[model samples]
Target: MPEATADRTVRIRLVDRTGRQVTDAEVTWDRLIRMRAEEHLPGHTARLAAVSGAGSATRP
Candidate 1:
């Protein structure tokens, strides 16, 4: 049997105060681009969302 390669597709979502996804960034390296486009990876946007806390009682 032949070995199967894994699919690489990265999904990153950047949400503002209103939970809107703002995905925008630069890729200077080819590896990064490939990884992002074919590795199912998550960049800073995903990281930020993961660390962000829920909205507070007070409004900005």
Candidate 2:
């Protein structure tokens, strides 16, 4: 059987105070979306599980 994998591609733009690129640091859209979801969402465990695909969204 072949293993399953989820697509984790994310594109984002980041700049410093001078509007210059920061080396060794790349912002990901998925991470930012997950952070915002965690901050505004109510339930803690549910939200975390949803983001990490462990509880309900997990692949069987």
Model 1 Cα lDDT, one tens digit per residue, 11-50: 4455666887766554334444566666535555566655
**Off by more than 4 A, model 2:** 1-8, 23-28, 35-60
Per-model TM values vs. the true structure: 0.23, 0.28
Each model's backbone clash number? 7, 0
Summarize candidate 2's per-residue lDDT along 1-60 as a digit string, tens digits: 112211344455655669897544434555556655775455666767778888554377
After superposition, candidate 1 runs with Cα above 4 Å error:
1-32, 38-41, 54-60
TM-score of 2: 0.28
Weakest 10 consecutive residues of candidate 2 by summed lDDT: 1-10
15 Cα displacement, candidate 1 (Å): 27
The 0-to-1 C-alpha lDDT of every candidate, in the order given, reads 0.51, 0.55
**Mind sharing the TM-score for model 1?**
0.23
